[model samples]
Target: MTRLRLAGLLLTAAPLALALPAAGQAQPAPNRTLRVAPHADLRTLDPVFGSIVITRMHGLMIYETLFAWDSKLQPHPQMVESVSTSEDGLAWRFRLRDGLRFHDGQTVTTRDVIASLKRWMARDTVGLKLAEYTAGLEAEDERSFTLKLRKPTGMVPFALGSAVGQIPVIMRESDAATDPMKPVTETIGSGPFRFNRAEWRSGARVVYDRNADYVPRAEPADGLAGGRVVKLDRVEWTIMPDPATAAAALQTGEIDIWEQPGQDLIPVLSRSRDVRVERYSSLPNQGMLRPNHLYPPFNDPRARLALAYATDQADFLAAGFGDEQWWKRCGSYFVCGSPNGTEAGAAPYAKPDLETARRLLAESGYKGEKLVLNSSYDIAPIGRMAEVAAESLKKIGMNVEVQFADWGTVTTRQQNRNPVDQGGWNLFVTTASGATMQSPITNIGTNMACERAWAGWPCDAEAERLRNAVVEAVDEPARKAATEALHRRLAEVQPYRVLGQYDQPYARRVNISGVLEAPVMVFWNIEKK
Candidate 1:
């Protein structure tokens, strides 16, 4: 698993002078404003339309969920005041928390909540499944709503409060009414912070101002739940693609926090007494290689299988993370170290077999068609994974063409469903939070609902049936059995290949406090002292 040259492949530090601010640019206020170097720039503002983590983070900044997960991953009411379930668990009633208002001063209503859920259902994997069981979702009054289910299930609150994938955020009815497939340009929400759209610069910076009218919950802050007290007046995200430049900024106190510093740059940051590196969540980040199932080569199961045989999890983990202490070669479709993380069907492709890969490629009837591999050079780990995958694919006698771009551009281009000649993509490498992959229901990669599936769009009826089994199981033992069956189905279907798992540690200044531990990054509780 260890590569001799892996350490050298990691990012090397650049001179601290490279991170100096432009002349005449205003400096960030000492304790009032907190400037952060985000891993990627803000491109997609519509949370429902984009499945990227950055978009989810943006959504959390200005939008609130009905329920949210605490640090322990337990569902707790956030925007909802209370929920009551029927004896059969088929019917549920929800009451909205008082004083909830959009940024425009409009009161939050059942109309908005229902519309937002409908929009979210059209996109989110869990929401899609929830819609299947929903008999009716109607408003009882302005602040209350009722959800009648066709069958009994206990996944309602968990699905609504999901912290990973595309979150079910409450938006204005007008914004939620916009087609789920299209982007909602307006950023109006009733969360703790308001997006400063006028101050946003695409590739450079983004700003958010504390929502003065926001009423924090009476409870103490915990993960994405409880009170979201805004201690700082403003939060600014400074896009720094280069790890070296970000490290320099953190060391010089130019940036209050660096969301994800490259593994190689950790030493550079550790040397600075002012900067502290820490893991935000206990769950590891799992890497994945998603193939366009609609396309020719990948559309064939054998071709996809060829990818599985050729993929070396060790190569990916070593290349992307460099440090063996930080990453592991995980074969689980569900994240390794998680409850349902079993390697049931992973035995066949546990190790790379170039001979088997070539055989599978031949059986798939693939000629010499070029496979477009979309990759991002802006993010270190993703870029390394792409490089390793391209090399592995070429070894299997596949025509692999790597298309390099910034993370934001790669994310946008991946949405294209056209042929490669018409700007479509064949494959792309990305990572999901381990928290999202802990179960069959939460993991978006396991979705095989054809058109409704995530970007890759891999459809398998058996996989869908198996996932439903896991969702419908009555107890832990039954659920585990169903999950293992689903995991086996996923391995055979090869919807998305799990490369490996690694911890992504965040670095911040010592003065920063109150950073909550959650699956994804949120800006509400942190304060710069």
Candidate 2:
């Protein structure tokens, strides 16, 4: 079993509740709310429109998926009651569980599921691959649907249940019918929580109320699967950009949970008796440096290789996370310690080589052009990693400029495809959960689909072919072989630089319990005492 480590020293501390009610306002009962300090501000609510993790968390809170993954990485039915495949394995049928109702008092039907899957497939990597093999998808009845594929593959259920980048969340047919590239105005779903749109304050707070009409699974909660029993009447997300203030809030009982606390503050938080720092997921998060492939310097593979040769994973990891126990050097494109974490082709660039970097830079014909490195100061780790990258690139004789902004602004600016002088970026630093980087099919960083690729716009025919082989392999051994080949290809192409892997522990009050172990932050199955 995956263990949840509780780190804190026992000490006498005064018991305190949340903020008192305003003048003339009635005070609510104790322990009826779960207050959280999220890692980033909630800017977008449409999960299918982008790969933002915060939006994915918001979607999970209000929307339900047809299937879900357990801690063991096994796919199981969530909203689905039963699923069966044909003898040839080309056709699959699914039936929704009874009593599933949307927050707007509408019954969940096959039309909603089909529309949601169609929109999700238009953006998610796994969904796109599934669409390639899909021959037909249609509703059989109000509560059932059938999907026919051109070839027999096991990706149907896995794709539907995957909780990776841009999760496949089921929404109302009316909302799902919106353009996949655009955001939906309405926030309606059949999940455990109903989004409080009227109470949403963009940069300050987001609110959700328990769904009284919703019915959960009978089984106990495990990872993202099983029953999602909500014990609290309300889940309030308070956005605190500063790490110090967030830690202070967690320690004083102003907030019940702190989704992410910096490593530098973990020690102080651990010393407090009221707060417990726990590792929620066994898989560590993987940090990456993504370069724009459409502009100069990085447009050439040699230049990308030069940057890779100059990078030191240890330096990047140490700067972002102070303690060595929280981080490790990783070279694999896929996350280290995962099922496909093989360092097959990373032998040459295992250590930093300034000579190789300089030589490669010269060969690529870089002319000291200004390279903008977009970074977010609000997220301390990302800002630190960008600083290290800027220094490393300078060592390779490249003109580097570090642009600092809040995380929301950074995320928005990186989407611009203009040149550096026109607000475009040459590189940026970010991290993905280990579960998202466990496979070539799921890892958005390794996607080489040219114009259709993730923000980086990496394009390589050989890399794409290798990834497809891994996805379409007949057996586990074949898939492993294909993945190693893809890894070797990625080393040559240098699509992105893998800084390292590290664990981001969660800090919550002692009164909070039943936190399910998962790669992502989940509200379900958690209760306040």
Candidate 3:
């Protein structure tokens, strides 16, 4: 069933190419250029420095990983020719596949892989945990590397194969040598596509040309794993901040795909029989509200709890997902309906009471403190949620200000950990794929490691301890107990709020094919007629 209600908004015609028949049905122009309008601009291509879906998508295009997970959620070797573990399980060795070479014509060696893993471990949440267990990692040969662990862990493969944000993308040793905290400016990898730097323009357009030297695995493509064969000669991403403009472009075939069509504009695109609207993945993107824990009114747990009470899940859900059927009022911090999902700390969110919120705020001594709510309308759903949150905050007698920017701008600013007065943010609206939030280990926002924590810089000793327990839990029951405990603690601390959960839709010309049903966008199997 379609999830959008009829929104009375006029559509404007935009200049775009002509539409071709559906994939395998008709031939496109002689020049095969796959035009795309992604959800946001490609602000940062360095996957280690950014966790946004757009950045991950970019990384998938120009970079390759040693291992990748398939649709069944099983890890498969991508660049690795083979892998083996010692009897004690404390040592693991991986051999690189033959013919693996970076775009610069350099072989992908064990030294490069070790350097990339080291840089990634210094940043990613899963990488940090992996580092803690890793006693030593060194190249054993030109093509093979070994990781000596302090303890036996079954998560080694999963960690290396993870396709979530902050993915451990392999790169040239020289490029990987860049500081983990800084972005790697060069775009060189063993992936099937090479960045067309000459045609790059920030906030305008980015292009990728198919790598003729790339070789595909014998296996069929599935999710981020298996064979990655680029059928198109080139893929160009045109950043259109305005949904109407992007929708028009897709309709006119000016672009081959619209990665994330705004919810409000979905109805307009639906009216076009020539256009096809498809959900990105089976897992939905969850709406979230992350609060700055360094200072505030929010630094106090009571104040954060007041904000949670101030929020009405129904309002945020309705704003983000127009139709009620498309979204859920997920009270748990974890993605509801997942294996470890529980209602442990959902009591306060059961019913929003402004009166209780007022009492809590008074108790916390909040003195009309101003909160800057950074919102990006480039994606309508996020902007709408922020608007709703701002109104709710204002109703509770707190000063709320909504700052406008594109999704890229918000992501860049969220990296700043300065005081709110010095261009820092109080809270921001964004979404996380349910695939990434499936566990405490993969979820970045769940970490409470003080200065090293995710963007919010939250610190909760109990939460951190519970997170570690979840990691160490061996049995299903024990993992469930640990997750429930952590969920309850998160509810009590309120480092971040799960506003709602909804799916993001993508629109493309009928001719486009091979859009994977994976959690992250994969352009490998796609082809244009």
Candidate 4:
């Protein structure tokens, strides 16, 4: 299986800087330690719990998977020595390197890999990546293991390489046995760094100290980290929720990096030599408003259509983002111009045509009824998008209303037949969406599934079936065809209106390197300048 690919999880923090530093600075640069500050807290240190921070900084430091991406985003061995598949495509064999050691002075073996797979199979929110591809997994010897599949799953390796990869990121056999999502002693991994202390001092400041034994593939510049091979002894992560505070810290070197700086400050950052701002309108970060198909108003296809038509996505973008392009106008479910995209949703829903909206409203039997929308954050700049949509419907002769609430409240309301005024949110955005594709799916299908698995309201059984087939089928044409079917259904239903994906900038010192271009920020290529 591939590594897990994350799409807009709000999990990781710290900004990125790809530009090189000044030529003649008298102030020396640090060799090993790289300082970073993110606005979110480290909710948990366990790899299984899956925080974005852990995925970014700590993933490379602590965990080593079967295969990893090199500087060019190409696959290379990290944990496993080599990879090969059986002719039937149901079994996979990995040759391991000898004498690999964990941070705790323990030797890595095949048992640890099998144990981690079992844990993911048992406790992961999604099914194990390589499970259906394999009937079971077992260690044959110290350096060998065989994975037997239930059926012919050709995408297993691709799955293993991604964030939600089929080949699970191997963990200590002991640590794999515990349930750390419940907050147990599951903070151990064989990465470059270990979990020190997760202190939510102000909002939340999670700090990590260097591992003395951590020696990277590249040689260290100095022994500043002391007896510990780490160049920097410690890494401090401060949760600066306020964009202003985050930017200030970066400017003053109080924080080496700041993730998620406000767009309003882009102009200020661009003019400064110390900071470099890089943001593209086309990014994997997209906003989507999904409705619960199992619930009222939404259950009616026409009502759902009414909501889709009434939403002026252009206005939503204009009001909230100022001058940024419509985040990105996606044709398919994924980011615009991404692999597997089908030009499915490029055109916005016909301008909140009150006449069309009203007709659908009446057909749906909702007359002058106020519709409510629940959201975790403030959604609209000019009147709530939900309210704007509702008003548009009203102009068409259907009364509607939109309401905002916490994520928990919105999710709960979406689950039941909640009121149109209170927690009844007919529309809401998805903070995270699991892409079901076998290899990598975040850029291709952020909200909808590329493979099998049901998500969101009024699930699509056909979509689910097609997704599954894509993952199982060996033929490339067959998989892509299934992707087309899924998109067609989405267009017909128009689940939540998807604003295009947009690139987010990470502010870093000019000297930093290897900030990932994909939504899933991996550190394999990251190195000090």
Candidate 5:
């Protein structure tokens, strides 16, 4: 079951020991503080520790990657100004922007990048997705570097586009090798936001100031440059998990913004004249559903497949949330509109067929045994989903037991001990970040193949084999064949059950500005509307 380690975090309303009295109708905005209610706080600030997507989104504030994803979702240069690969496609050269500087006053250099990339390759399996594509990288000049691949792999840059691939911050090699957790506590990057301070107990309310020295500009000839700059002087993410309490604080002007209010409260919050609810499209998969590979029953693919029969995904859409628009459909792992996704359709793995499910239950050695469901996310929606699924599974002869988990219990990658491994719940549901961008390598590496992460089911050789073929096969037809084969196998094995993707909800005061669909809400874009 998915654990939302910080979902229930309370938005404690302490008396404004430091309060600025509200003026009549409108007030001039000083630097603003937005109180967002993330279902779970991020597991760690260590980008290398968690999923690439989480790290990359976090990196936007404290670090910079080589490439960036454009509004159209195509790859564009970021740190590196212009890149040219060898005609053989085995070697590539990058011309880094000159004069890029870190918040620590260190000018960005090629040596820093080589050190950072080596560090990421050492620990981050997701980052290794890029490693698998390239043999090695060497610094050429103060602003130039070269990457040598094993073969004519044109997909190198495209592959980096996967989660953290879009951005790889170059760090001083000496500094990176010194700290196991680099850039988290003491970090340096050439991005817009500079990390100030972070403490976990006070609920991870990190303070970040702007990186004023960053001077990477896109020339008109190069076609992409001058990213939207940070407009705010100070940004703080106050830890808040309880939706109602967060909404209450936002209403009273305690914080400038919050996000993902419960459906029940959407109406009540929407009626407030002082606030604005901004919704953006989420990734293609509904929240991720992990069937316990550690548990004996779930170890069997038949059991996993039968479990899929328990939930009526169609009904989940109708009743998944109070706001129908919040639950939407996605075609593939990458966001629906990217280069990898196909047309959306009903998930074959989610169709509810009690008779077939009953047969699977019998074959999987369950006459009516108690099966525990583990979850740490918002109980309302998942509880609703479970209740419906329980009734359906009952028709197929399963004694399913429902239980609760602290939303933050799952691996935040900040620390160890995954809740799915300890909670004994057979099913875990939560949103998976970053892998959706595409690097056939990053997309499937850990989500399904990494044995350490999925304890119950050791790494599947065939899964990796199929996935690798897709990533390495330069020929389009072969790549398609490999990907299609993997999906068909996934449907049969049921490693994960997708409910369908949903929307991202950002609730801010009417005067607050700068809400983009980016995974992490950008602070620089914020100003009073």
Candidate 6:
């Protein structure tokens, strides 16, 4: 499976010199430590439990997957030595590579891979679908495993090589044996870096030491796959909630990289000759306004549709990205320019009309109920979207209460299902990469299964049926038709509001090299000169 390609829109600015140390100033050697200011703090270490962006980066540092998606979105063997299927298509065999050792000096075994897959399939949507066809998953020998399916399904390799948040990463048998719902306390893997557990401080800083015993693949680096090379002896990730502070730190050479820089600070960073700003992925980050379907106002389909129709994409786009070149007004539920993106049956959200929203709210019997909107001040995009949404809702005559917190806190609070007065939320802002939204199988946020739905808990039988159809589709045309039909139903059901799509850039020192332009941020091939 080739990696999905996104738009070619990119932003790169010439570097300008900032006042700095004189020539006499002694500079530290650049071959050891590489400090970075990530987008968010590391709140959770477990990859499955920590589905956020920051933790996903941490997962890449410590863990290694059997098969990983390349720059073309194609799956390549990583830990696995080879994979072959029987002529009957009922059984698939996998062999592990030699000389693979965990952090604790244990050999990577087929039993460990089987244990890891069992845990990942419990929560991941692709894993659940694969489980439906899988009759048994067991170790064939110490170095190999076999997956027996009740019927032919060609999705096993793709599911195992998922590039999104819920990646099927391998672990030691002891750690992999833990309950899927529970968080693993131990961090041990055979990746290029080993977690320095003693140096870890929750919400503050985390450190990783280069693995001396690890060996890289002979193939060159390509996206998430290929060689795992670590040039730096130590990598440090420090948490800085304020964008201005992070930019200042980067300017002073205190930090080597800033994962997600604020759009407003791009000009300031551009003035510094030491920093270089570039978009890592071609896919833009999509803004989303998710409403809790279990509560009032949004529970009514009319009320939800009103919010979507009342939202002006231009307003949200400007607020979040500010520049026309950095953002695009995407009217479709799926990404606008992607293969699966379509505007079918999307007449209601073409324009924003305050009068239409007011009428819909009145028909839903809304009596000025307070809508709790969670805003994350730490992330510029999320905060800006929430602010614009609050003002838009007020114009429609709805009571709005904005709750401000950090990104991690907002992520934690959005999962609560309690009543509004009991610490529950009514609305929140989130963003997804275009790669995650390109197809129904990868887009977990759109799941509408009754009690097993994603965050907002939308229960739409028609949408669920359409989502399944897309997954079971035989080819591209069939999948496209199902996706188009899903979009038509989504417009009427109004599970969530799409707040346009925008691009984000990463700022790093000019001396750093070997940075791959991939969706997920990986530090393996990166080297600081």
User: Considering every candidate listed, which one attains the maximal lDDT?
Assistant: 1
What is the lDDT, from 0 to 100, of the residue 35 in candidate 4? 65
Query: TM-score winner among the candidates?
Result: 1
Give the Cα-based TM-score of candidate 5 against the true structure: 0.78
Query: How would you encode candidate 4's per-residue C-alpha lDDT over 1-529 as one tens digit per residue?
Result: 4322222111111111111122211212225556676534444344444423233344545566665433222233455555666665566777665546687788888888777767655433233334545578878898899878887654444344444322245788877767633423455666556666454253356556565554343211111110113435456667665567778878887776666566566667767788877631122455556665645666777877776666666665544455664254454564445445565443556455656766886787765555555553421221344444444556666544455653334444544444554434555554322222212232222233322222233555565555565555445566567667666666666655664444456677676665545324433234555
Clashes of each: 0, 0, 2, 56, 26, 8
Clash total of candidate 5: 26
Model 3: residues >4 Å from true position, as ranges? 1-31
Candidate 2 ranges with C-alpha deviation above 4 Å: 1-31
- Candidate 1: regions farther than 4 A off: 1-31
Quote the lDDT for 229 in model 1. 81
Q: TM-score of model 6 relative to the true fold?
A: 0.90
For model 6, how does the per-residue alpha-carbon lDDT over 1-529 read when each residue is reduced to its tens digit?
1221211100001111111112111112235789999888887787865566776788889988887767655566777776777776678787777778899999998889999988877766556667767899989788899889897655666667777756788888888898887778788988888899899887789899888788767666788877777778889999888888899999998999998898889988988899999988877768888899998888898899889877998898898887788998886776877667787787768789788888998898888988899988777778888899999999988899999987778887766788878988999888887766655666666767755566778889899888767666655667678888988988888778888788888999888877787767788778887
Task: Determine the C-alpha RMSD for candidate 5 after optimal superposition of all C-alphas.
Answer: 10.7
TM-score of each: 0.93, 0.93, 0.92, 0.73, 0.78, 0.90
Better TM-score candidate (1, 5): 1
Q: lDDT score of model 1?
A: 0.85
Residue 229 lDDT (model 6): 71
User: What TM-score should be assigned to candidate 3?
Assistant: 0.92
Candidate 1 vs candidate 6: which has greater TM-score? 1
lDDT of each: 0.85, 0.84, 0.81, 0.51, 0.56, 0.78
Model 6 residue 365 lDDT?
A: 82
| Root-mean-square deviation of candidate 4 | 8.3
lDDT per residue (tens digit) for residues 1-529 in model 2: 1111111100101111111112111222324889999999887788887687898888889988988877755566788877776777777877788878998888999999999999988888878878888998889899988888998766666678888888889888998988987778788989888899899998899999988777777766788887777778889999998999999999899999999898899999999999999988888889999999998788899999987899999999999988999999888988888888988888888789999999988898898988899998778998999999999999889899999988888988877888877888999999998888877878998888887778888999999899878767766678789889999999999889888799999999999998888868899878788
lDDT per residue for candidate 1 within 427-502, as digits (tens), equals 9999999888877887888899999988889889999999888777776677789889888888887998889899
User: What are the RMSDs of all candidates, in order?
Assistant: 10.3, 8.9, 9.6, 8.3, 10.7, 8.0
